[model samples]
Target: MPAAFPSSDPAIPTAPLTAEMRDALRAIVGEKGLIEDEHGKRPFVTDWRGLLVGGAGAVVRPGSTEEVAKVVRLCHQHGIAIVPQGGNTGLMGGATPWPAHTGIVLSLGRMNRVLDVDPVGYTMTVEAGCVLQTLQETASRHDRFLPLSLGAQGSCMIGGNLSTNAGGVQVLRYGNARNLVLGLEVVLPSGEVWDGLRALKKDNTGYDLKHLFMGAEGTLGIITKAVLKLWPAPKDVCTAWLAIRDPRAALEILSEAHSASEDNVGSCELMSRAAVDMVLRHIPGTQDPLKADTPWYLLLEWSSARARQDGAEGMSEKMEQFLADQLEAGRVLDAVIAQTGNQSRNMWRIRESVAEASRAEGPGMSFDISVAISSIPEFIARGLEAALDILPTIRPYPLGHIGDGNLHFSFMGPSGMDQQTLAQYKGAITRAVNDLVTSLGGSISAEHGIGIDKLDELSHYRSKTELDIMRTIKRALDPQNIMNPGKVLRL
Candidate 1:
């Protein structure tokens, strides 16, 4: 089970939703918009990983931004808390409401729509409930590309992506969700809509208010819509798999690839031998790219906007030459260049299936951390040593975007360890790894925000001054603390 909220009010009295309030909400959202039965609310209350589960007075689905505002206003007037949720695919427990707290889930799944698309301006206006894959396909249809790609793109909604400032494979090239968004339309805690959706690339006015809600995790307000930036589709692309000797060799290859390709490197992902083994074992029909096993592997890719690039060799040819040079130099043990688009996608499938494969293996502790690109090898070295010191049988499976220095460093327990035994060492292992990350000038939470999973870690690692500023902002925007209470900050 997940840890309880530190500031949970046990002595406080609980109040059930009144008939009048329910009737008013029903009037605003209609019959199909409300989910009050226990059976109906189960799907909304449980998290994606089934780690955190809760209860809700109701799960209210609003079809438009105006209806969402009305629901928020009604909840505000009644002193009831409102938990804004979209897709509910978050790894952390941010969108899941607490069982002890009585609140209604304000789901945005029904408001999915692409409002407008401007090919000339390279912008797309979309409702918050639009699926991320839908947005990507829409952009492709317009002869452009949405660079935000992730494993959960098929189901995760744009609202949740904006709420968490999600980072994915393309972040090393295009940046996170924050960089892709040009403006936002948020409904403040006071139930007033702030329409700041502008598609301009340069706006040197005053403070950029859209940033306040980008990674706020819905603590300040609800993100209803957004204007997203798009990019020209890449005409030429290449993918390669490299069997590296170690992390140092991986970093060296990354540097060489960037230099040789003139900064055309799109993504450089690292996977441990243990991680690859897990995927091959759990996922059927998956084969190792290399004939023999190595300590680590890199799934590297490059792309260019122009198809031919002034009659020079394509990216694939360049990558093939680069790999040939590295192999001859003994830096890379073995390498393979993808021959077709299907082959390229198959290579990525192995990388994307690691998380699920690891979970299927057993109970384990996972972390999303980042250090300086130069310190990655050192961080991994010391992290493994520390974890082994605690438990010699611990299996470390650290893999992620090596180009950006953010890795999902996870450790699976020994084969026969029970859940209780594994749970006992979760905190100590987390502290040990996090201590190493911080000591090396890194962040404990890299791409993932400080959701309920990392609340205590944030409070422990963040300084008093930083926490004070965050608290001040939270208080100023949400004085009543009714907007996604007990998230991102302790009450």
Candidate 2:
């Protein structure tokens, strides 16, 4: 983690939005698409947590790719910076403009539309602003599935999801957001549209250009539309809550689950008892599935496209048998398979609500990092030792998408300590934890992209060659450095 930026302006394109330029923007998009009022532009400039307040002269919502290109073209001509935003639900300040930004916030909200759905091809073409949950439901309506899910699915847009290359619980099965996309239509910094919206699965024509923009945080270009991959809908699914012996047991159980469930392990999430309790305490309508005398728990789900018929041994039966075997092996101390839809929903609700619960609990630090699957238990052990040594009273609630080796390493500040006080120790605590991660060949910022939060950390952790290549790409694609200036890379 890195310290927050100072109030003073850093080097960004300060070209003020002139009256003529505003008129040009208004002409490109209708009045409803343009938000020049301070109150109207507030949400676009502010980060999701409301902790980072940025400044923007206006917020421009384009209804079409054409409109988006026109707005970018106008900005490019005048040397004005543009921060491309989608859903504005990003944890990183990638979509939020800098406090000194005197240009526009290009919002994709008005452009949301599902353009096409090819059931035969198993693909869907959609505008960038379409909400993730909306796309999931759309896929369901077509009897297909979109597996890129997240806690913020209801509000996070697909463009933002791709921009951050987001990873959620299902990444183990469906891969990250980038993996779910077939192609993209991006508006480059020079106002040129890159129409790479092919629905083909195998296009090795040249450099994988779509990938560059997918995780670039809109620093390289503005993603306006995309062609997304779809999978067959899961008809037989089983959800379970298990109290495991320890972190190491989690790995073993998951390792065996693939064959036991016939290779349909959709998700394997590790939850600390503290994390579960925190969720149960804050989130209403969520209940504990089981209470066992163990500090570690696992939320395992197995799903398959094959529907279960009468007299068939469904997912639950398979899972029940698997749990029995694990319990006999001394791996799972206790476990319960979800018997009803409501029961399954409750189990998932607890896992998804951890972020909300943490916010309600107050001042806390969370690091989203990933390591080799086998290295997870060791990383957890050494990482906790290092963090606790720096701040002994720090409350630990270590949890994650354990199957994918990504941990939401989190902690509550010591009792009675305010956020300001906790900030003083953040540097040391961050270093110890990240050092352990780096030593194990793990990522410091997993799932979450390097926005303002980890801008300096990326610079510090990445090799000079890696950073140099990134800076070179950023410069070549956006020479003016006006595309989301002062984000990701410091150049």
lDDT of each: 0.87, 0.91
lDDT of 1 by residue, 1-491 (tens): 54444444322113457889899989999999999999999889887777677777899999999999999888877777788999998877889887765778899999999999898899999999999999999998998989998888889899999999999899988998999999999999888999999997899899999999999999999999999999998889999988988999889999999878778898999988898899999988777877656879999999988777686899988998899899988889998999988789878889988877876887787899999999999999899999999989988899999999998998888988866688778878889999999999899988778777888788888999999999899889888788887777775
- Where model 2 places Cα greater than 4 Å from the true spot, the runs are 1-3, 6-10
Candidate 1, residue 48: how far the Cα is off, in Å: 0.8
TM-score of 2: 0.98
User: What lDDT does model 2 reach?
Assistant: 0.91
Clashing pairs in 2: none
User: What's the TM-score of every candidate structure?
Assistant: 0.96, 0.98
Report RMSD (Å) for each prediction in the order shown: 1.9, 1.7
Instruction: Identify the candidate with maximal TM-score.
Output: 2
Judge candidate 1 at residue 374 and give its lDDT. 90
- Count the clashes in each prediction: 0, 0
The top-ranked prediction according to lDDT is 2
Candidate 2 lDDT, tens digit per residue, 1-491?
A: 22356433447899999999999999999899899988888888888776688889899999999999999999999999999998888877888888789999999988889999998899999999999999999999999999997788889999999999999999999899899999999999999999999999999898989999988999999999999999999999999999999999999999999999999999999999999999999999999899786899999999999999999999989999999999999999999989899999999999988888987887888899999999999999998999889889999999999999999999989888888788888889998988889999999988989888788788889999999999999999999999999888888
